[model samples]
Target: MAVDLGQFDHPSWLTVAGTGLGYALILAVLTLTMFIVPWLVFSAL
Candidate 1:
């Protein structure tokens, strides 16, 4: 069942931008850690 979107107020530009930036930063952190941890462990040899 699809919910009605029109019933809710649309997000403002700042709200949308903030959400996008938040997700991007979180993804970047996870990606960086994924590579960094392995590199550190392997380089210790």
Candidate 2:
């Protein structure tokens, strides 16, 4: 199940910039959590 966003192009640079930052932030958080949880549990004695 998915909702289509239609077009991928933006009308201006501001929108593109904002979206790029938002995507990066989301990716960073997901990646950090994915690795951190395992490391934390494995290292804890």
Candidate 3:
């Protein structure tokens, strides 16, 4: 007899990878604008 698994469908790998990349992009943008740019401006003064 064959063993049976659950019937629920899982998410695709592409969807998971795309979501991770999008999150990283947003984090990088926020870090650059919020911290790096201001630091550079003030340090130059």
Model 1 C-alpha lDDT per residue in residues 1-45, reported as the tens digit of each score: 999867556668668888999999999999889998889989998
The whole-model lDDT of each prediction reads 0.86, 0.83, 0.86
Q: TM-score of model 1 relative to the true fold?
A: 0.59
Q: Compose the digit string of candidate 2's lDDT tens values, residues 1-45.
A: 886665555477668898999999999999889998778988995
Candidate 1: clashing residue pairs, number: 0
After superposition, which runs of candidate 3 have C-alpha atoms over 4 Å from their true positions? 1-11
lDDT of 1: 0.86
lDDT of 3 at 14: 62
Task: Per model, state how many residue pairs clash.
Answer: 0, 0, 0
What TM-score does each of the candidates earn? Answer: 0.59, 0.61, 0.73
Of 1 and 2, which scores higher on lDDT? Answer: 1
Q: Clashing residue pairs in candidate 3, if any? A: none
Model 3 per-residue lDDT at 22: 100
Q: Which stretches of candidate 1 lie over 4 Å from their true place?
A: 1-11
Poorest lDDT segment (10 consecutive residues) of candidate 1:
5-14
Ranking by TM-score: 3, 2, 1
